[model samples]
Target: MLGLLSESEAREVEQVVAAYPEIKSELNAMEDALTQYAVAKGIPMPADLPGRIIRRLETLDKDVPPGSTTPPQTDSGSGPILPILGFLLITALAGAIYFWFQTDELQENLNTTQTELQQLQVNCDQIQDSLEQIVLSLAVLRSEGNQTFIMRGLPDKNPGAVANVYYNTQAQQAFLDIRELPPPPAGQQYQLWGIGASGVPQSMDVFNIPQGDGINFIPVPYLADVSVFAVSLEPAGGSPSPTDVHMISG
Candidate 1:
């Protein structure tokens, strides 16, 4: 009804509204709100508003002679109440449409900005995690009198599996860094084993695999006369000896 929308734009809006029936309900709600507001304000709509205006124009035409094209004189009195009420209602509807369009545009922009910001936050978190891993690895490497061990999985079944161990004999500090290993089953767990010179697999500790790039610091009970280190999937608490074959060992 207003000239705010072009013909094509109005058609597009109509098509969109037709595609989503929910928009009809929203328009209905707006109409109801306006009706309720008019009722509350005790505003009366003239029943024969248009018919009365037309009849007055016809009377004026009859009063003027047929050949005479004289314009009607302006009445120096208060304007009709119906016209004033119609103007106020149209002005209110126009204002509502203006705000509605403005709010819709702002909401779309807000959604787009939020998506971009969330992506940026994910990237920042990944970068922070990598930096923390680097710092931890550097700290281990820079430790005094450190020893390193390479852990490899069984060649036949798990050729690609590998891990690393960092140990310092003087300070008696140890850490297991799992570089390549798959996640275990729900009930299964990974156990670290320290092999002694007499070919005995010592149960070091039981731990679950870390989620991301993380190192599990394990205690070193005996660093002396250690020959090999290994990891195996065992029951929850772990076994005294290597009940199952080693998944990764050196």
Candidate 2:
């Protein structure tokens, strides 16, 4: 018989232990309180206390009693089933921890995969755009009688550098093939211009030659007549007026 805990002490212990979400864990907390209470009162714990506790726990487990089940009748409030409930609480806590870590790992992996997929999509779009531009360029060349103009690079620049200009007299379109020309320096680009006999230059098209084998097409506006075609080096997007003539051809 355990009557070591005072009435007030027993009430406090019950309230604290019952606050747990799992009543089974509360049962174990009650057992610990009882053991401490007995020791403080100079009462030795019974030798068969563990065996009695296991037997009572087995009965309660078989019944699958509700969380609100009343404590088993005993001389004191402490019951033998408390130890078993504590073991069950520890097992549940361990399982919850394992699941939480597993879920976090899965989320991290999903985020990594999503990032990779987005990068792949961007690469695919760039490739598709390049292919479309190439197809359009070829179609324009085949549709008209194209006059090829070899635009020779100007002096003070790299020699042997040249660009091919395909002028379609009927369609009045110019397709520039800069595949043979070297890449422009940083912050600079090649801009095409239509040179009139009056020595005035009209903005035609401004474009860049891509890193490898670049080709581009520009629709030539009908200017009635033009003396020559010119290319100038300007800022990246191109200047409103020609700065320096890089190459010229008639």
Candidate 3:
């Protein structure tokens, strides 16, 4: 049917088809089946294909003996089925491609949502930490055993600076509130000191001054037997003892 036979074999097959009506009808049926299969798989047929087939059939009819009848024609009812099947195949393929694109878009949206959720989680953590710090500062201020002291700036260093120190001896906790302070120079930080009766200043904590105007509450080490609290401007890492006292409270 596909002209794949050798020359002699082709001749023999043609002779057989001409001699036997049943064989001719079977070959035609097989050819039609193959054409339908190609259409169902979305292979396009040429526009002149029907005309070509009719011409070929007329040529074969001319070859038939004058007294012999033509072979029975197969039913044309199945002709519409192939085109319907081809349309369905094409529609299915289009639907599949559309779904693949939709899935890709959905995946990208999911990734973006996950990133936003992670950022929200980080914000929640920061808020929780700030709340905890406020609660601790309040506890230090309200405690009965807490000692409160007011620190004033030195006349020469920073006369405008002032702060409050809260020391809870019973709980061994200390907090400092900066009421007014200037921003430290680059590569420098503010250091807190706990001066005991021995006249020696113990290094407590070093911190950076925030940019805003609101008072900042900071936690510091609660050293034993301290009689005074002080703050100093020091290097990046604080010195062992005070280098330049900015504020003091006895």
Candidate 4:
């Protein structure tokens, strides 16, 4: 069809097409497809194309010797122009659909980034609070009248947990340094207790572990004549009496 075949090959193709009507029909369909492709790609074609083809047919008839089989050329009309316009419309619709999806994806990504930034801010605030607690605890420990005591974990419950209690008897200031303790159970917190000489437990402070890893330096109420410092796992706000004693120091 593209004039790529030799003379002998062209003759053979012509004979085959003549013998098979289905082959001729398929070749005609291929010519129409090529014409549509050319128009869609903006390839220019002369308006007098039919006239040029008729003249070429006349020349071919004269050039070919007698008794030689001549292959017929398929005529492709202005059928390709309408299909080219349809192709352009489909392309425009596809582009619009792609743009809508891209916009939705970008919006989702922006939402994710904003959520991550909010989490980061919350982490930063927690870090600041922890730092303030550490500074206050350090000041209390370095004071002149400060007394330090080591609270050992109960063997039955938490043998590895330990706490360092710092108290200033003159200033009535106290801080509990949690050196090694596992996180509390869900919906629970650690409660600090001050046991006086009378053997009654007084609730000093109740606190929770922050989200990330860090040493907790918590300030607690200092009781006068307190002989023992203890910690217990209790409900969120703490229990009046020691409900679950885990660590104790005198």
What tens digits encode model 4's per-residue C-alpha lDDT throughout 1-250? 4133346544444444443344445545644554575467444444554354345334445655666444333345443443343334434433553464466667768989999999999999988988886787667778998899889999999999988888889888887777888999988989988888788998888976545556566777778988788889999888878899999995
Task: Go through the candidates in order and give each one's C-alpha lDDT.
Answer: 0.62, 0.63, 0.70, 0.68
List the candidates' TM-scores in order.
0.55, 0.57, 0.61, 0.51
Each candidate's root-mean-square deviation in Å?
13.4, 14.6, 14.8, 15.7
Please list all clashing residue pairs in model 3, or write none if there are none: none
Candidate 4 runs further than 4 Å off:
1-81, 154-161, 181-192, 195-213, 231-247
* Tens-digit lDDT track of model 2 for 156-248: 864556776777767776677664567779999888887766888988767767564445554544443555777888889988889978888
lDDT of 3 by residue, 98-177 (tens): 46446666776898999999999999997787788678777777898989888999999999998888888898878888
Model 1 earns a TM-score of 0.55
Query: Which candidate gets the maximum TM-score versus the true structure?
Result: 3
Using alpha carbons, what is the TM-score of model 3?
0.61
Clashes of 4: 0
What candidate 3 gets wrong by more than 4 Å, as runs, is: 1-81, 210-217
lDDT of 1 by residue, 116-176 (tens): 9999999999888777877777888899988888888887646778778887777677778
Per-candidate count of clashing residue pairs (backbone under 3 Å): 0, 0, 0, 0
Cα error, residue 5 of model 1, in Å, equals 23
User: Candidate 4 clashing pairs?
Assistant: none
Give the backbone clash total of model 1.
0
